[model samples]
Target: MDVSIIETSSLGDRSYLISAGAVGVVVDPQRDIDRVLALARDRGVRITHVLETHIHNDYVTGGLELARTVGAEYVVPAGDDVGYQRRAVGDGDLIDASPILLQVMHTPGHTHHHVSYVLRESNGGIRGVFTGGSMLFGTTGRTDLLGKEHTEELTHAQYHSVRRLAVELPADTKVYPTHGFGSFCAATPASGDSSTVGEQRTTNPALTQDEQSYVDELIAGLSEYPAYYAHMGVINTRGPAPVDLSLPAPVDPDELRRRIEDGEWVVDLRERTAFAAGHLGGTLGFELSDSFVTYLGWLYQWGAPLTLIGENEDQVADARRELVRIGIDDLAGAAVGEIHTLVAGTELRSYRVADFAALSEALREKDTTVLDVRQRNEYAESHIDGAINIPLHELADHLGTLPDGEIWVHCASGYRASIAASMIDRPGRTTVLINDDYDNANDTDITSAT
Candidate 1:
């Protein structure tokens, strides 16, 4: 049996395509089914089942649509109260897939109905297990997504679930998880690219620490995830609309400006430095990069009209795919061209981009208002001595509270800083984008710890 990993690095999740001879099974597919389809086609395998470990809180699942398209059984954990049809499965249920058998094991933690599938050859030899959010590489999935009331209960459950897997499964059995590659669904930052049950026994917190210690650390470590995560679980459980990846309608310069004036989300998808150099007034500089979708979705008002201004059609198309993966479909329109042309007769907005060394020099000369837009935990761990902490997610509401003068904005990386600086730059305020990695700032005299 061969297990293929389909990684969606943007969301820090993985989908599995397990194949044996001509039979194939897909586990936790993303919204874009074409990728999964192509993989199965290339492997020359017939998909017989599509399995979802839980109702995902990070991205829309393609399992239902993929199963419907291929005429395969759609398997969901029993008791999720889903809106669509699926073969609701429970612990110990064995699914026959010819060359391999999938043994379901109920592992509630990530969600109330989460389950893992143990892959076994038809002859009953174990291959590996798809543990979804239950058992990640070195940590477990976050338990607080449901609500504050359920956090403690779920944290305890998560501990027992990982312990159960460690005890029941073979030490050398390969472990595959859907979240924790960088997904906010993880309780903490997961370690390594790959791991086995045996490796986890020595490294995973659930195995090394006692239940109380693990629960305490996990609950305390839980941090804020994307605000868009609230919509993902609902979309997945109620059956997400089929993904439409086709480019949004072409918006002219006039329409783009009108939307921007109307306070709609007209995001510019260029490199941060280029965006800082010149961009349309009132347009958000959400440079097209790995971290773009996560922050954009977090700050975007759900169901609001969103427009994109990209350097070219390909950039807009790339941004659209990333948006759809997180259930941000139905774009208002997009304008693609040089920034100058897109601005029409209006003058483009610009900001200063500099490094930490420049910030250090400026700080030494006089008092400067520094804005650190990283998360609260990140700000607490270490930061510039006198910097203000308004995390990027909460910056919009706190803009008026910032001290007057030229505000210098920064994050761990320059991405969030660029977004914050663009938001801060207006007719009345002077903003500087500290476009450098935060670690480099440690070399200067301004570094401090709380």
Candidate 2:
């Protein structure tokens, strides 16, 4: 069996293409279907089936559309109420794709309708398991995505679901999970991406702890996720629109200014250093990278018209791809060129990028309020003494509560702090960004509140 792992780095999500003989199956595909289709073409195999572990709550799935494009069967969980035609698969059902045999196993933990597909060899020997959002490298999927009420119940179910895989499958059976690779869906940060059933039995926290202890630990470790996640579940249930990879229409300076005046978001997708040096007034600085989707989706208003500001067309295209994954398709336009030309004499906003030593000096010299924009769990683990914890997601709402003085913003790295700095920095408000590595926090004379 030839198995290919297609990783979407921005979301840390993985999709698999398993081929046997002349036929193949795609599992947990992203909205962009061309990549998966290209894999099949490269392998000289026809796509026979497109499988979804569940209605994904992170990014839009390309399963239904990919199935239609290739004339393949779209398979989903039996209990999912996805409003579209699909081959509803149930537990203990067997599917044949020529040389690869898939057995469906119901693992209701991440979601009540979640399932794991186990691959068997020609002689019915267990080969590998696609454990989407159920069993990850060192941890399991976060149970709180559904809601606070369902957290404990799902965590309890997750314990048994992981055990079921361990007891039923061979120790050498490989495990491929959809979440855990830098995704917020993971209960804890994974050690790596791929692990075997035997390795998980010994190393996975979910399998090592008792049921209640596991539930408690999982719940306690949960932190704030992207607000855009709320729209994903509903979008998946109702069927997402087909993805359009066409570049957004380019807007000139006047047009961009008009949209901004009309209350549309003008997001600048540049590095934090470039953004901090100089940027258009009121423009949000979100660096185009892996965490781009997560933080942009979290802070951006849903359904609001948006205009992207980037260094060039390619940067704008990259930013667009990331946004489209989370269903933020209301891209009004894009502005690409030199920053000065885009702004055109408008007073550029700038913030001071400080190192740990500079931050300590600033704190001592003035009444500077150190604002840590990391997640709650991160803040709870360790933070600078007397630092105010307002996660980046909640910053917009808590702006009024900021202390009346110089605000020093920071995250583990400067990515999130740059975002916060742009949002909070205005004419009168002086915001200094601690843009250095937070690991160097221990090197400073500042006390850490552990």
- Return the TM-score for each candidate structure: 0.99, 0.97
Per-residue error (Å), model 1, residue 265: 1.0
Worst lDDT run of 10 residues, candidate 2, spans 342-351
The numbered model that scores best in TM-score is: 1
Candidate 1: list runs displaced more than 4 Å: none
* Cα lDDT tens digits for candidate 1, 1-450: 889999999899999999989999999999999999999999999999999999999998999899999999999999989899999999999888887799999999999889999998667777899999999998999999999999999999999999999999999899999999999999999999889999999999999999999999999988899999999899998998888999999999988888888989889999999999998889889988888889999999889899999988999999999999999999999999999998768999898999999999999999999999999999998999899999999999998898777889999889999999888888777889999999999999998888
Model 1 is weakest, by summed lDDT over 10 consecutive residues, at 119-128
> Which candidate comes out best when scored by lDDT?
1
Candidate 2's C-alpha runs over 4 A off are none
What C-alpha lDDT do the candidate models reach, one value each? Answer: 0.92, 0.88
Per-residue lDDT of 1-450 in model 2, one digit per residue for the tens?
A: 888999998898899999888999999999988899899999999999999998888889888889999999899999988799998998999877778789999998899889999999998799999999999998998888888888888898899999999999999999989988988888888887578999999988778888888988888878778888899999989998988877899999988877766767899998988999988888899999888888899888888888999899999988888887888887888999888888755777788888888888877887678999998878877888889999898899998898766889999999999999998988887878889888898788775666
Clashes (candidate 1):
0
**What is the clash count of model 2?**
0
